[model samples]
Target chain A: MSSLEIKHLFGLRGVSKHDIRLILDHAKQFREILERPVKKVPSLRGMTVVNLFFENSTRTRTSFELAEKRLSADTVNFASSNSSVKKGETLVDTLRNIEAMKIDIVVVRHKGTGVPKFLADNSNAIIVNAGDGAHEHPTQALLDMLTIEEKLGTLEGKNVTIIGDIRHSRVARSNLWGMSTMGAHVTLCGPSTLVPRNTDLMNHVTWEPDIKKAVANADAIIALRLQKERMDDALLPSMREYRNTFGITDELLECAKDKVIIMHPGPINRGVELDSDIADGEHSVILDQVTNGVAVRMAVLFLLAGGRNNENA
Target chain B: MKMRKPSSSEFPIAVLKNAKFWNGKSFELRDEVRLTSGQNGDTIEYDCKGALVLPALFGFGLDFMEPLRDDVYTCADGVDAMLRGGFYGGLYESAANPIDDADKLTAAENRFSSFGCLGSSFDIKFLGAYSKGFGTDSLAEMMELAESDAVAGFGDGNGVIPHSRFLRLAMEYGKMTGKRFFFQPMDKTLRHSGCVHEGAYSDMLGMKGIPRIAETIAAYTVLETARFLQVPVHFKQVTCGETLELVRDARKKGMDVTCDVGLYHLLLDDSCLETLDSAYHILPPIRSAADRDALWQGVVDGTINAISVNHTPVLRQDTVVNFEDSVPGALSLEVALPAIWNKLVAKVGEARAIELLSTAPARLAGSTPVANNVVVFAPDKPHVVVESDFAGHVCNSPLLGAELPSSILAVYINGFWKEL
Candidate 1:
């Protein structure tokens, strides 16, 4: 498909930097709209959103719910703990059940990849991948870019480094796309194996095994929260060792350029993938990423939840 | 090879002459085999042989092993499975070699995996014809060599390209054989040559070695291969967190991928090699302390499904050499239980050890490791210390004089037990 027009925003697989620019550019106007006299508009007053999370997630579920509520759309949270999914229900069954609820959009965070696309295919509801395995987390990617642009005012030629478990992170996939598309030179620095070694995928992406070298002189550095569940995966040898070598601790921050912004997709591991100091530091845009998640997601919910297009309005 | 009735009933006779071993080199049975009883658990008599025995043992009979340089013809053995094609240094049409440097395999393939073809490289123009020719060569070679000197084919295979090509071949060959193929990709986390664990041992000794990546990548590759093949593939030995994660995540994805951990992997880490005992070196190298803890979790949580000796037999001198230059191998089929128990009983216990070495691996490998590699040890047997009277061709058997619990009595193989 041509990058000229977006056929879908289902996953970051075929989409490129241009799509991200267009989406974020559209999101920028929405951000400005939110700054206007009216906070709630009739853009999506009656449509419904099915927050179908087969995996338990507090921040993603809550953020999407808040985004929907702020956009005046009816939000329904279908958690796996109480759903028939526990009774051997396939994802299709769950999505079908929600489809019967007349939901206009489905924001799903599944433990496996392709579930979002599958849901997007089987039903009329637009499927926004809340997170899908380690593949792609688009909205998180979009909000992070919003956070970057807000601080630096421009992203072109900016060096942005994403550090963490690249192999198992949807966040990394999205941010890499969103940042690189907006003219930022994205460098992914991690243990070489965790970094995607596909050279073509590494377009404009400089893979740095040496963490120190990758973090220095960057306009923005986004630290992904290495899942604690991944400890068993043994991505990092030990928690202490990872924090020392890869974590954005006070010590690591000392190496960053004075204006380098640190953003983490959070529920921080305290001193594991990041130090508590840095997570709560002045240079952090982490809190901003959270704030923008709601707004950008609000925009997404508005668009997907049947907001009138220019012609229809 | 039965001994006289009154030799040593107390120790339990084990056929020591059938001593087979593997080192990515010559296969042989140059001496007498000795057998004894068992130590801690996995109660059965033990005779620590190596991969060289696969051909004799499988004679349409049993199965076993970790990475004793995997199968050349069969898709069952995972590592270097590319050798199955037996076409040295030629191109595998639909396959891509996974390893960055795979051409180095052509010569090895001819000497090892092939029966007749001496051509270099794994180039296969017509898979159907090549595979037929390949399988026919095995028959021809078997008939060519008299029964007295014939080493039966146990599918010792490899490929000429990188690992990816081997994977593609395995998938195609698997379709023909109807065998289950699984995957476990290498965790790209700890990328270099992560030999020993990366924790206290490497840090304290100021030594640098492989971290979690080596095994994790192996595991991830397994999963990816399994996905590509759409088959149930199991990684034979997994060592660290990244690998464990790959297995766990793959399983969660409904991928028919499983993993096994070696006793040494779950027991020792890089710390074991800090003082420089060559016996500590082995492939899918050791991991860090936390990776060790994760291995235990991998075991406790039922994530690691099987265990192997990774039984790549090493000669004593080589194991005793410099750490980097020293070959990484040792037999764990005989010591897996006791070694695990030695390290775990205090923390987890004997039950956990039993689950890891016995019931678990047997179930994973389909009712037990191949017969030729099976050992029946009595838990009450005295520890077999290496460095003293260790069997096998290596004067440098790493465990020599090093007490390995359990005495091996009779090894069950091909419908008969080889007596010591």
Candidate 2:
């Protein structure tokens, strides 16, 4: 694969299918490296990576930190809650300070949309958006893609229904772009309030408010976590209504193909977006998605840090 | 010692030779139009060949940050910006500092008079706040303000009065004073906290959506109230198709109502928001392509009375932030005239464009067009809009890099010719 020409992985909005395939190919190698006795690589040695998280996150942050360590790069963790950011230092000031430290890569998860793009435009370091405010979560999408491709062998012509609060899910947006680029027929299902009103603008994507129709004949079904705060905001009437309307149950899965894969980005609200039985069912690839996250992030960091210069040559 | 008045010899008659001006009806080419000498004695002549001269444009509902936030724009900068846009005069909606009472209104009038007395400047009529602090509770001292001769009208400056009852009362009271009430109709409840138009684009961008219902509902409410009060209410910055329909219906029913479309709305739609540039972020946010088409039709069909630059000049730093956090306005004055000519004249015709930009606005503001105060436009002269062209303090122009087809060759104000 030609060297990933992208300087920063902000979002998967305009990322090409060829580039996604290349990243997935590299991630497969990283997944193999995970099974080795010594799970460490000298590919990104001597480079410093900073995880600048303005928003709280456990899974994405840890996954990036582990990826940086596995690639043998020096890592710095900066959480806004404990850092000088609490003192009211502006985002640009804090980022300039970090850039002055000569970090090579900055993994940022900010609560503001377009924060990663802002940092990329202003700073010298490579930016990887961990997750921006309901905008894009490229790494999570890539890991989910890896899990999907692994189970289905290919994403081409596959029916992947992403059901839940898609309006506020950066993961759903990134996956929709990434998977749709790879020739998957993606369906977004939920209440009209949860689904974006402009899904018609997205190619190869359709809205299905009926969960059964969305899951019927699907090769994969990804249930998004319903944000409980949406209830208070009146986006959802109640959790009980949301579950009864759009939640994924075993019976819903039976509407799909015989071996349909079930995926969820972790920290799931068990009964809100998905039934407990369906979350723990045999079709569930939820844990595998978490396991693949490290490899996908490792591949992203490696490629962004000029991975194996000789390999490209 | 008393200063001697300048003699006629010292103040040469400034003549615009071979000029054509839109005479409130059609373009009439004339051999010469002479400007009588003023005290300044700075006189000049212009050979206006193949240029269409029209009444100096009157911009209605323009926001200038002066006396309160002078850092954004002062009266001088506002005048300079308006002159650059071919406007010799405009109504300044007192947005930065709410002119809510007789004292504040007089202060604003005095400030403008003093500033105008300084040098070659434009006439700036102030629009007083409709409600005290625009809080939608107490009515402003409209009678006192009118008696003080401080305001041409009452404006709510891009805000809905929130309470229709209060708005009705304000309009009813304003009716007694013979002052027009200008407002951008919006229901805060329907608007919620959304920034952009509620449609596919907002949904695609994941930004909160401010639905068209927010505007149409408020417009309907305001129209109903206007009908009940039998008072003329001027709606500023109408952005939606349904809002235009409402206005047309009201006008057809012989209701006392007038509405204006933003110049940007005539050319741009919500599709521009796809760029995520905050300059496109505006109140009564740009709607869909259908809405834009309807706005053009409204202008052409005479349903829309005027077009405004809606020039709300903000500091440069204020627009450089995130799309949501950035101030909602654009640096429009420097490019307003040329942009309108380039975008609208072809579809609406030159005569209609002049009526919308000059004649109609002047009539709305209760002013008449004087023959000497005119702008000469070289319609075929194409130039790209750039930051260097702006004399205003703010550089938040949405059309900063756009190539437009019309240029102001010369502008005649008072007895002087401003050549570009």
Candidate 3:
């Protein structure tokens, strides 16, 4: 249960309650980084991080790359090309060849939800999932938690709403767990067909079919991007209709308090789930989420790959 | 069951019978029948008000069909005394399964009366098995949103039920419906990227192994979940006794739960696995004789309630395995009655065998046998055991259709009879 044992964070299933308390305590130490003057720390200095992208991404990938650089760690981004993929080297072989270079940690974004997890299992160094196939985006979620906690000054007793595709958005999936642990009221808003067939699935989340009701009196609303490419035809009626009902327009913004902030895991569609004005406005934390994304990813890389900070190397 | 009087004025004699299963159909209302008890506190008495007369059928067929569909076909027109509004108010009718459509499912699940257990799957990185999370508020909302018309793959068309998410969903459904939902404990379909179980024949034939660990983990996960939630957990058609011992301990801890063994477990063992007889290919991998012995002990000791057919309708080609490579299960329901009657009576007793086969299974399914769908047997009858002779509805038994001692004479479902 020692804070140092947080090195084994992912090894936590069938774990003792006392062990969980230890990980949370360690997390609390990094949790304090949110309040610092220079949020970037060289805890992971001299380490080399490789961002291997098997699928396309901007927000998570760039944020991770920046997070690594900010930590004074060398960052390498190698995306796959159709030519090599078509030439047919198995993904594992492709990764092993890259891994032969002795990178300290691999920040992987793959289309398979467990691809990063699978890599973590096979690799010698730490593996952080920049994005996984619908399974999880742990770092993205922790940072989202950081943003919510900082904006509201406290996560306990806060009402946070996640609007859009709850089913496919790994952001929403991880956020549900993170927010629940921190004791936030998590409300999910999306089309009924899209709101996940298993509501009984999440223990504390309240599903609202109506966006207005979902965001009303909320401390914050997190807008998730629609993966139009990943979805098939008519997953929703249309982008326009999806916006009319579930989207975040200026009218729906009225449902929130004046101090309520808007957040997104970007590269967002300007007119879809959000307005361009909102994305660029004072209340908008879209950009900040991106900025904090780096900080959070830095914290993750440090904890995961840098061995130990505060503790002597 | 005592009648609870809402007030001193009247005691509601709730004859919650499936009357609609007995309209124009004919059934024998037996006035008198023999009474017999098997294994300690379990017994069969002439609960029937009359000799339930029906057709006599002597053969093999694991049937999922309900009894005669043309009966009273009526429900009280009055509003459900419980819920004030809805067409279901006054009277209730009968159907194969209720809460099938989207609209009624909403009302059925979301009401204050329905806290169906909604569940999700839970596991940590590198964890060999997954744990379960149930009864989340989010799941409650999904129940309200997802109109009822959901059956089996009710949630997703793509079968993308995140193992962790599905556990929570099931528990959530249970919480919502105020009903305990049972999950198939053993899922060989989800294994080290392989389907079907591994058997000794696999080793001999150099086949891929589906280790016992997979099934053990599956059971352990369900057991651990029921322990955490302290809710009713049902592990279906358990074939191994080691697992039953766990359930016994869990139940003793005051978890409202139960377990069942499939008919095959009582009849076959890992010896079947040695054939790599594709016919024996099943999920849990029909295990060793020791395992079967243990399973039988579980049944005799009341560690399990009823014997289930696990009546998986599969094609014969599915069972054609090189080693323990055949599909793991066989169609056993139709032959279930005769199989037990042939093998079990000598081990337990005629009465105990029947209880294991009929009365017990009916109760497990919440099927209250009201004079109909009753199996009448002549205990003294003797029959042969030939693998192919055993009629398994889909494909006859791999034992070349074996014939056991007792023959099935009749089955009465409603007020009618159909010769089988």
Candidate 4:
């Protein structure tokens, strides 16, 4: 039990509670380190890591880059927009070219699902999935868990409701699995059109189509960002309709307990998913979630790099 | 290519000493099964016990992705694969070239026939294209292509022509040709980027799901249109149970419609997609287990006409990527027979199982069974599939590394018994 149960952080679907707890405990220590004046560590001093982003992202990539730099590891950033990927180079060729560079770990975000597992199968380096199309994002969910534990003391026996596009949100998928594994009661609330169709994923959580009733007993609420393309895909009628029905506003919050905390995985659509006042309110842990992201990712990269050592041993 | 007359002495004569022969109705153990070449009509006694002899299977939906350049001898490798897999002949759909005219059809036939002269003779009935590349516009040269005697049927090679004004005109025009129109039924709007059946597994794996309604809606339209035109229609690779129900109802109403299910659809379901293995990433995506059961029932109740060996050869690079990005299909020729015999022997009787691959397809294709062509199979023999077992360049068959219960002992092609 001294080391993590899993070597790679692909997703939280089959991940163990012990592994989640271990990552959270290490993130707590990393949190303390970030508050120091130097804000750096030498845990991974001589290692090399690569950030391979096939999609556009500013937040997750920055957090991972900062975490690698803070750990004193050499980092190489590969973005598909300005690289050989645009020259018709396949994913395998791109991975082989990068692998030839002798990196020790890979943090990849791709539009295709199961890409992390694919990279793990094709390469010797340890893998950490940043996000794969509609699939789980483990570190994001871990940061959410860390934020919940920091504010509410413990996730066990807590009522956490996630409202908004549950079908397409990788954060919702990872949080549902990671949170449920830690003994939290999870509720999913959204438009009937946006509910996930997999009964297995829905089995562990409560699905309430009524938003007021869904948040009434919630100890914590995570609001997901609604992608505007959902309208073009005919999954939603209009943005105004989605905002009126599912947006977290003051009047809708009246049914919730006084001690309830609000959260969002950010770059929030200001007037769409969350109101401005509530996002900046005292009860909101949105900024804290962002702060915890760097620490959680640092814990992940450090552990996976060490996991390679465990395998060698 | 000129046909050279093979000497009579080159023919093979074998007398099976106690082997089970499938006589169309049931398996009968014949003490002395003499198989002589049609050319010489000569026979010799031989000791071959514990083997089952069956008529060589005729595949309906065979596709071989011819290499860009033929210096690799992929055509010869594909023919060897077909013979080793117990297929003597099949309808070969030329996927690379749109066979919109008589010249393209003749070109495809010549390409396949030239392979026959390379020591292995396999019959390939080529289908002509009804439309241009991936569009609803009808081919202006369809009438010329339909008039050719070598052309087997008219179809959209890999794309589906949605039931629109184009389809109505095509079918109405097809009545003059007196040929069957083949359709790969699917609603494109319903199948956008979906790689697997829309069910719990797809939702869990977070891959896009191809809904059953995609096939059902399209099949319903095809059947009703065929009824309206009174033209013969054959549906290729029907995957959904709901589509089978529509076919059953159409057949009951005396409509001139027939359908064939892909062999993989009968053997695999959406559960195999759990690993996200590219081998299971196929077109006419594998449906739910319930749909598979319904497909089996269709085969049993005479609702489905034939089980096609949807043999698509994909390069390794096309399948080595992520699941969704991987190309849809694998080289399924060499593994088709063993997969069918092993999976269907217990479910349906052995006789019906062989007919699904052999006589049923021959009857549907309107081809007479060749006198000397047959397959000698060892049912109890176990062989492990390996990379060298596949003669072609690339194959990502799920059967790779599997232990198949039966092995094809030999196939009678080009009037000689070629041993495997």
Per lDDT, the best of the predicted structures is 4
- Estimated TM-score for each candidate: 0.45, 0.93, 0.44, 0.94
Q: What is the C-alpha RMSD of each candidate to the true structure, in Å?
A: 24.2, 3.9, 23.2, 3.0
Per residue, candidate 1 scores C-alpha lDDT tens digits across A111-162 of 6545665566567777788986655788888898788888998888899988
Q: What docking class should model 3 receive?
A: incorrect
Which parts of model 2 are misplaced by more than 4 Å?
A82-89, A307-313, B1-13, B17-32, B37-40, B47-49, B116-121, B148-150
Candidate 1 off by > 4 Å:
A1-4, A16-18, A32-38, A197-200, A305-313, B1-420
**Residue A281 error, candidate 2, Å:** 3.1
Error at B283, model 2, angstroms: 1.8
lDDT of 2 by residue, B47-142 (tens): 899588877888886776767777677666666666666787787786668888888876666655554342234566778887888787788888
For all predictions in the order shown, the interface RMSD in Å is 18.8, 2.0, 15.3, 1.2
What's the distance in Å from true for residue A1, model 1?
Answer: 17
- Candidate 3's C-alpha runs over 4 A off are A1-42, A82-86, A229-231, A306-313, B1-420
Instruction: Give the i-RMS of model 3 in Å.
Output: 15.3
* TM-scores of chain A across candidates: 0.90, 0.96, 0.85, 0.98
Off by over 4 Å in 4: B1-18, B40-47, B67-74, B116-120, B139-149
Quote model 1's TM-score. 0.45
* Clash pairs detected, candidate 2: none
The CAPRI classification for model 4 reads as medium
Report the C-alpha lDDT of model 1 over B1-420, residue by residue, as the tens digit: 111121111222344444453212333553544332332222234444431222111111111121232221111221122121010111111111111112222322333234222121112211111122223221212212112111211121221112556555645554443344433234434544344555444432323445555555555665676677776665645666676777788888888766666656666766565345556666656766677788788777778765544544454444433354466666543344434444554545555544455445444433333323333333445675543222223333345466654444444332223333
Question: Mind listing the fnat for each candidate?
Answer: 0.00, 0.35, 0.00, 0.65
What would the per-residue lDDT of candidate 3 be over residues B1-420, giving only the tens digit for each residue? 111211111111111221212222323333343321111232223232222222121111122111222121111101011111000000011123233344433332233122211100000000001112122123323343232222111221111123555565555454544334454455444444433334433322223445555566677776776567555655656766668878788778887777667667677775554333455655545666777898888877888766655544344443432322233445553345555665675677645655565455444433333332344443445545443332222353554446555544333222111123
Best by TM-score: 4
Candidate 2, residues A107-188: lDDT per residue as tens digits?
9998766778778877888899999877889999999999999998999999999999998889998999999899988998
Report the alpha-carbon TM-score of model 2 versus the true structure: 0.93
